[model samples]
Target: LLTPGLRGSKAPAGQNENLQGLKEKLCLMGDANSKNYRPACSLCPVNWKWFGGDTCFYFSEKEATWQESEDDCFSHNASLLMLKRKSKLISISQISQKRSYWIGLSYGVDGWSWIDDTKLSTKRMDWIDLSSKQNCAYLFYRKSRVYSENCYEKYPWICEKAAVQLI
Candidate 1:
């Protein structure tokens, strides 16, 4: 099947039918003015990750340090998961079962904050106390909880961006 946005100069017979099927299975088209309409759709192409809701998540299988993971996500025009809402956090936790992954939270001179510089809200976080030396935060998939770890430690990471429409 042809991947989205990779259409050839000429489609073989029945290609239009196949494309329709692909769209029905893999894409969710929302009203242009709806809250679900995402700006990222203009830039995203086929093979991009698509999760339900307004955000798309990319779970990296390769392990890397927290900084490295952040860089990788940046390269993809995304950031490590910020998880602003408790419901979003819980949904991500459920989807990432049993596989701890680096998130966007970290500690710096200013104190704990997301990579975007937003302060980490204790009221919304599910933190597990760890050693003072562990300054980076990760999602502990087994229990769907957040925990601190050394920033240099290598682990798989999750990247998130606004959901996009497949061209």
Candidate 2:
């Protein structure tokens, strides 16, 4: 049967020496205890802003209209933050205190929906005023609830994107 170092015939003398050198180099690199060895996910990209739960979140300090915020997120290859899980609210609240940040929800012809066109359910939202005339939704940190605001009004925003997988 064919095997390494015995492919059809024995490797030439010089070829064997080259293979041995390569093997030693690979062994050194593969050592787990080596100081140079680091996990693939040890460092996230500087632009990711914040990383959690396989997702990256960015909180903007500058204020912008809801549409402008959406555009900004798109430019970064992300979208306006859409909290699908209730648990994420706590994380968001801790990051933003006494400030309102634009999310993805907005009232349109089909009622409230995320910028990605996903419909929002009343059961999943904590709205402060359901009857507000505003069309865009923002989170109020103090109450840890959502409130409708004029879409034209400028406000800080949050963006979200899927975390990069480490190879």
Candidate 3:
């Protein structure tokens, strides 16, 4: 029942440990000199989760093909989740215990890359298998890995968009 207050790191007794860890992990993220301190609470949409750096993430409850999922995200003016680091990917997966969610990665004929056409880093993919048939990526929470699947298959997805700011 506890929520993040405007300031301070207070939380209920049993929840403090998890909250503290989340705060610590989040501390390692985002720009230190950014103007907006906590944009998620005030700027992000109601259903989206604030993911530091003015990024709001929306986790879908329903399943859809990768293309369909991307279209859905576009409908909301967002894009498929496109994280690069393994630890960052796992952190987001931990929050979404629901199931695997389609991300913004795929293996095109040229090579593996994110939706924005950025190449997937070899160092980051070192531990991943990248099976031939499975081209699209998803956050596999049970294993804390970014596993791939056939893009035609259906799976729940995550959408990412910047928190709206009025300047």
Q: In candidate 3, which residue ranges exceed 4 Å CA deviation?
A: 1-42, 124-127
Better of 1 and 2 by lDDT: 1
| Per-prediction TM-score to the true structure, in the order listed | 0.69, 0.70, 0.70
Judge candidate 3 at residue 74 and give its lDDT. Answer: 92
Models, CA RMSD each: 6.6, 10.7, 10.9
lDDT of each: 0.75, 0.73, 0.76
Instruction: Give the best candidate by lDDT.
Output: 3
Give per-residue CA lDDT, model 2, range 1-167, as digits (tens): 11232436655566666655544443333456878663322113465555444578888889999999999999988899886666887888887846899999899999988788988866735534446778998988888888889989999999987755332
* Deviation from truth (RMSD, Å), model 1: 6.6
Worst ten in a row by lDDT for model 3: 1-10
TM-score attained by model 1: 0.69
What's the residue-level lDDT of 39 in candidate 1?
Answer: 29
Task: For candidate 2, list the clashing residue pairs, or say none.
Answer: none
lDDT of 3 by residue, 1-167 (tens): 23453244445678767755655654443465787554232257788988555678999999999999999999999999987876667669779866888998888998889999998876746435577568798877777677789889999999998765321
Writing each residue's lDDT as its tens digit, candidate 1 over 1-167 gives: 44444544444678868866666666556676998664223324344555565577888878999999999999988899986677777788777846899999888898888889998776734444434667999888777777889889999999988754344
Better of 1 and 3 by lDDT: 3
Error of 3 at 72 (Å): 0.7
